[model samples]
Target: MKLYDFPLSGHAHRAHLFLSLIDVDFELVAVDLASGEHKKPPFLALNPFGQVPVLEDDGFIVPDSIAIMVYVAKKYGKTDWLPEDPQQAAQIQRWLSVAAGQIAYGPCAARLVTVFGADFNANEVIARAHSILTLIDAELANRDWLVTNRATIADIALYSYIVQAPEGNVDISFYHDVAKWLRQIEALPGFVPFPTSKAGLRAIS
Candidate 1:
């Protein structure tokens, strides 16, 4: 398996974390997004959307971070992570949607604005995204992971961007539950640190 990714992408990090948790061995191919490589012909052939975290598994190219997580869980991980019950699977899917939808638009977008200063309305984006975080904080008030009673793909999918919310200037100090959850994720066996650069915007294209 080969993972074509930008090291600093939170979306890519989700797949990275899941692969690590499952102890899957794969080659990492760095795509220099800084040079518009993703948009170039070679990379575009792998993913037309020009996104990172494209997983090449035995000639199958899987794009989208959330989809990669689902694939890994189904193909390699224990049933506990992916679950077998339809209701449980639905709930997990709901949280994954939260990660890809609300969390991506809110906290992730805020971080991009704060760190990269991308040309978006930061205030409005943050305002809308904060509500999602508040919902997560409340939902996680008494839980260890997002779905079921233990760690799942749901947790791995959401962990990277949500934990790094501070880097985007979103105050995470008030989200005590989230902070605790972050620590728990860090303590998990086979866990790896989120990749960082000396300058936060060093990887921006």
Candidate 2:
């Protein structure tokens, strides 16, 4: 298996972490976003969206971070990463939706502004980040994992940017439960981390 990746992308980090957690033997192929490599024909052939973190298993290609997680979990993760039960699946899907929507436009977008120089209202996105973080923190107050008794793709899908939200100036110090939840994920076997950036108010080396 091969993962077309970018070093600083949370989306890429999620896929990388999940693959490592599942003990998948895969090679990382860095896509040079600085050189427009992802926008070129070769990479575009793999994913027309021209995004990093595209996965290639044998001849099979998968794109988008969430899509890649779903595919990998279904094929390799069994019940741990994604449960087959209808109710559990629905619960996982709810959080997955938050990952794609709220999490995307919130902390992820805030970080994109500072880290990538994206043209977005930083204050607005940061506020959105806190709002969702508050909700997630509340939800985690009574649970260790997001969807099930064990960690799932829902947790993996949401882990990266939330942990890195401080890099976007979204203060995580106030969300004790969220912080604990992050530590729980970190304690899992084969865990990998998203790189912390110097952008925003908080800095991590």
Best by the TM-score measure: 2
> For every model shown, what is its TM-score relative to the native structure?
0.93, 0.97
Model 1 RMSD in Å is 3.1
Residue-wise C-alpha lDDT for candidate 2, range 96-171, written one tens digit per residue: 8999999999999999998999998999999999999989998999998888888899999999999988878888
Candidate 1 global CA lDDT score? 0.83
* Model 2 stretches astray by more than 4 angstroms: none
Error of 1 at 24 (Å): 0.7
Least well predicted 10-residue stretch by lDDT in candidate 2: 196-205
RMSD of 2: 1.2
